[model samples]
Target: MRSRLALPIALIAAVSVAATACQSSSGKSSSDAAAKDAPKAASSVADYNPQPYDNIKDGGTYTTAGTFDDQGNPFNVNATLTASRVWSWYNADAITYSPTGEVQYNPDYYSDVKVSVEGGHQKVVLTINPKAVFNDGTPIDWTAIEATWKANNGSDKAYSASTTAGYDGITSVEKGVDAKQAVITFKGVDASWSSLFTTFLHPKAATVDNFNQAYVKKAHPEWGAGPYTVGSWDEHSGNITFVRNPKWWGKKGKLDKRVYVNLESAAAVNAFKNGQLDYTSAVDAESLKQIKGLAGTEIRSGGSPFEYSLNFNTKSPILSEKAVRQAIQESVDRPQIAKIQFQGLDYKEPLPGSAVLHSFQKGYQDNVSAVLKYAPDEARKTLDAAGWKPGSDGVRVKDGKKLEVGYTLLGDDALGKATAGALTAMLKQIGVRLVIKKADDADFSKILSERNFDLFLSGNRSMDPFAARYLCDFYCSDHDSNITGSGTPELNKEITATTEIADLDAQNAAVNEVEQKALQEYAFLPLFSGPSTYGVKKGLANVGATIFYSPLPETIGWQK
Candidate 1:
């Protein structure tokens, strides 16, 4: 499950939130003192214009720019964030999020959600709203929940699951008082039990082939139940149009149609300028300038729950050695990249220290600095010690192999392209060859599932406030979402055990300790935090960045 994670309307890496005391391997915050000296954009939450439901007009068409990838299926283990975002629009959400990151059951899908401790096991009773029905008229019931659990609980390896963390903890998902209620029982106590069952898969999709292979290039809108359903999808242009579901039982959607077009950063901005798109990314200097003096559009800026990181494919030959990965991270100057990234935007932040928590968030600490730092000279020495010798071409060579790494970049954003170019030069200084591959927005899911690059630069955007949930996502080798391939059986056991802790703080601390060990493997390097900037038409409401809150389509439309 994505747990509702994705980059919408042109990807932009942003910030995080949590109350954590994650320490470095040395058991201390290595950069807390340095953090005290800098200004931070995360001091404020996202400023997406919020208006009451009554304030939105009854009907309109809201078209926005977004990436479209052939992600196989929304529930496929190899599914990309793009696929998840598109799937979300046409599916019923079991839960809804407030702008401040609070989770509440969506009454449209559930009549009641009861959590309790029965026989020392955390149990959840979800009462499905009887009025809820899929587009195909399949009644929403325990069968669907059971099917989702069976496919994602890692019980059958043939069925590819994104992560078996929350699902693995469940002992059984049986019918409750009736078919409308699902009685979910966990093996042990889990404080974050509410995080699971956020979305359900169709009971008919329980087969391995259907879960993993059969749905590529298919939205399968018939299996979905929500306010909107896919009206049309253009395979050539990678564009999709959604219309109100004729069989929807909930309140009517505010807009008559929602259109998502695959547009690169430059093209998205141009489209927005020409009134073709309702939303466009402007987080970087160059993109922001394109809309500087636009009369009808405004830039919305504030904290976001997206975080940027470079995931090292440790299974690859060159990066198989932890030392090489560490050296590469040390050679890259993050501050230089940040300065270039936020140059003209004036978005200030202390050097980011944690991939899961931003500086302005509660319990935020510097976990990255103690493990790695920008020291090109030291990095060179480390590479030399690791048996990578400088060849006549100036690139490092070991065992007749050059220390070359492939980096996959998506879209044609000027700032993203420039950043990749800067990274190429930075790695060259350390005698490592950085080969760049620029791909279109539509190829993102393909590149990720194929592992086509040694280094994948992307953001882990969150839909919930629980950062501890990602421990398994990033540290369990069997978890398909752990793209780094650095997880071990030992780490997986530790993370799974940590999730069972009854206290939130104890669970967080235990997860942090295990995280410290996993990160030392050097397969993941933390980079930028936030200041999510988006150019939006003035009257659009309940859309754009709202920190971690994702509003339903029924609540987003043109302001009256």
Candidate 2:
């Protein structure tokens, strides 16, 4: 857990207070309150400083802020902060999955090297200016790549998301024809497998008993690979600094060191405003406005295929019945929730693609108009058909059981809590009782892992249409990981058989058929797809943005 300075209660309270204050500041009559209090229109990514690194002066430090605990060891799978930050300091291929889904950064930015893919397998055959060398002067090669895989899989100490993110996968590793080529094999044909590898390649000297122990812990001089190295890591003071990696093989003379301070957004914002931080992260929309108004600071918003949906705990008495679940979904006012949660900046519905990845399949969006619209009357009828009837208190009852269902959500999850609160209000009119139980991140994950919950809420990181593997994992009973506990035996057989089909069209057809089957069963509710939002420092160059939130430091250079 990366330690974060707690935002004073007064500071946290100020956000809601500021929103309320906007009403009075707008100077509109009470009758026009809704219109006057609306959030400001969001700006496009193109409108900001297009070249974030253009004016960046070399040898200076860059700092960003966000919410995380100090215990977040970048070397451990315990928290994303450690692993994510280490990417800028150390080099590796294991756990270094790029969001571009394949090798090479997204076209939105530039990287000299490109990954060539054939036979549905991606290969790093092409080298980009062999100038790419490790911090200890070891040349980056097929050996380095192989060592990374071996250290993570072959060795005893391996750090990965399954261990860190509370799930496991990466089943096998295989080397390609030469040192310059390699292929990672997965136990199953999961689309995410290719994009989740971020293990770093350590110098041969750092290897310990066949394991890369130096990079496995938070020890430094572990061979700085990016533009910076650990200048200071004062855990007691809650500060970490990275000085320029003189050995950084990039187009040098562009930057010196980058400092990473472990602080929450509030302090980070203040530091950036006071000029202590060159780059900062904006935690919410309000902070974005603050960063934009500060001179020489730029904001960028490109995130994962950010999504959220209500997870119906099928174990609940009321929700166990299909009709009751349908009724709850029908009563949700999606547009209203979108307006409040997304502040009207994002589209209110899922885009034309599978819920797993962020790409459109022609005509997919055209078929979703009816599945998501609000239909209270239909909801009531569905509940009625499911044997639930209104009682004296106007609450629904089935077989002498009241149609009251409890929901568990993350307490610190602002968006989820807001959405659940909205659902609570909406369901009240339909005679359904909803109880919200607050759980910390650990408790929530425990429930999910145990398949325990009346209803759950969460988000997806990608959005590719026909992401058949995702549907199978979430809706197939045979996949023990599916949380809903509602998959049928027949569905599992169909999912497995479809995997063997070789033809692309035939595979897609099979996937769509599976999706329809899952939808009919209400395995999961589809939610809106929205662009990720980020706040960046102005003049930082070559920081290519992708659908996944990983940074491209190799392509980034300071201009000033």
Candidate 3:
């Protein structure tokens, strides 16, 4: 049975609340610091103006930092795409984001069905729309939908390890009256299953043979259901450009051409400022400030569901101990990190509350903030109480072993490295030895998957809460979910049930209980929750550009 812990605020990462934290200087009160450094408000909203097509070129390229390589190699059709690029080509079980952080998906535009919580589970029912069609001109129907699942996750023996792994409770996908209606049965009514309604439907004919040979390798095989098709590829440059689908199933092309270029941070910014690129998204605070003087450039501030955090490797004996974990958690100075490390650009409180785990609602900020903050003295006492003795080097030693914690830092971001250094320095003062290692993204992921590090910085961007399902699998004992080989069976069972709960309230309740228990046990440390900043070029109209920062549709194109 799932443990019933206290109801915490539902921050996407933990507890639930819709409070906002103002960015301020490190070590000062948030209110006092924000007052001094805040930027002046814009005088007035600019009038809308649309740019004419004749004035704009049909094909213009843009370069951005951060590689879409994590989206999975397009060369490997058998690979499961994990980034936003995958979601752009294929739909999900459901869409969880909107232009304004709403929880509902626009079914009319994205799907023919409207889903809601019923009987403690999300029932899959459809609303008939005669207009929806596939790129091949095939009328959108239940057969195509069912076939897509079978080819990916069902027993057709074609593909395995799909996005539908989260929807393990799905019993069958069957056709209903005529071809338009479909019935999806589950083992139980699940409110969480509402997340599975926006899946990308594939053509039965294309995937019936072999996905790799027939679909992926072939030049743009007819698979995706979006408004664009895979366009040109530059092997040497490491880029994939997309073109407007002349036969799009949804709204016709709003932007002329969308190109995704993978380059280093400095080069990308240089390209943007020199007019070599029209628009670029996902610019951090420092990059935003660098190009503030560029003509026609405007920086748009927004919040993302992405949570940046520090993971404590349960495999290490010292970290494997509960008291040491708590001591580390207690020592983090969030206010200082927000001001000095993150430059007052990120959300001030890291684990303020839990509502973030459920929805990116506006009112859910502070419920969790009150609980998580720096208590350095408490952290020191906790370490001492745990029988750790300070040695000549000022590092803690217990049972003849030194408390040497390793943290892997990606060399790309300066702020990230600075934050890591600050954390290492702070920990050292408390008799804890922190060793920081530098690695690229791919190597870090490999090390993390192999459970080779004592600690590291990692994050996830997803509106759906299922990503949290992997938490228990990361450290639960004797369980394949135990990626760290340090999981305890009792804690594993507590989190397992949180993922499978059918009732929204009950599931949330269960998750809260597990988090409290995990916090008590110091299972994983939570850091700051913040936004992915972007600089929007003036006069360029786009609706959901940040939605696809890692690469997919480059920008929701509109002329100003």
TM-score of each: 0.90, 0.67, 0.74
> Candidate 1 on 32-111: residue-level lDDT in tens?
44345445545446677898888999999999775345554555666656677777788867776776567778899989
Best-performing candidate as measured by lDDT: 1
lDDT of each model, Cα atoms only? 0.74, 0.48, 0.50
List per-candidate RMSD values in Å: 4.1, 8.3, 7.4
In TM-score terms, candidate 2 sits at 0.67
Better of 1 and 3 by TM-score: 1
In model 3, the worst 10-residue window by lDDT is 1-10
Candidate 2 RMSD computed on C-alpha atoms after optimal superposition onto the true structure: 8.3
Determine which window of 10 residues in candidate 1 has minimal summed lDDT: 14-23
Worst 10 residues of 2 by lDDT: 13-22
TM-score-best of 1 and 2: 1
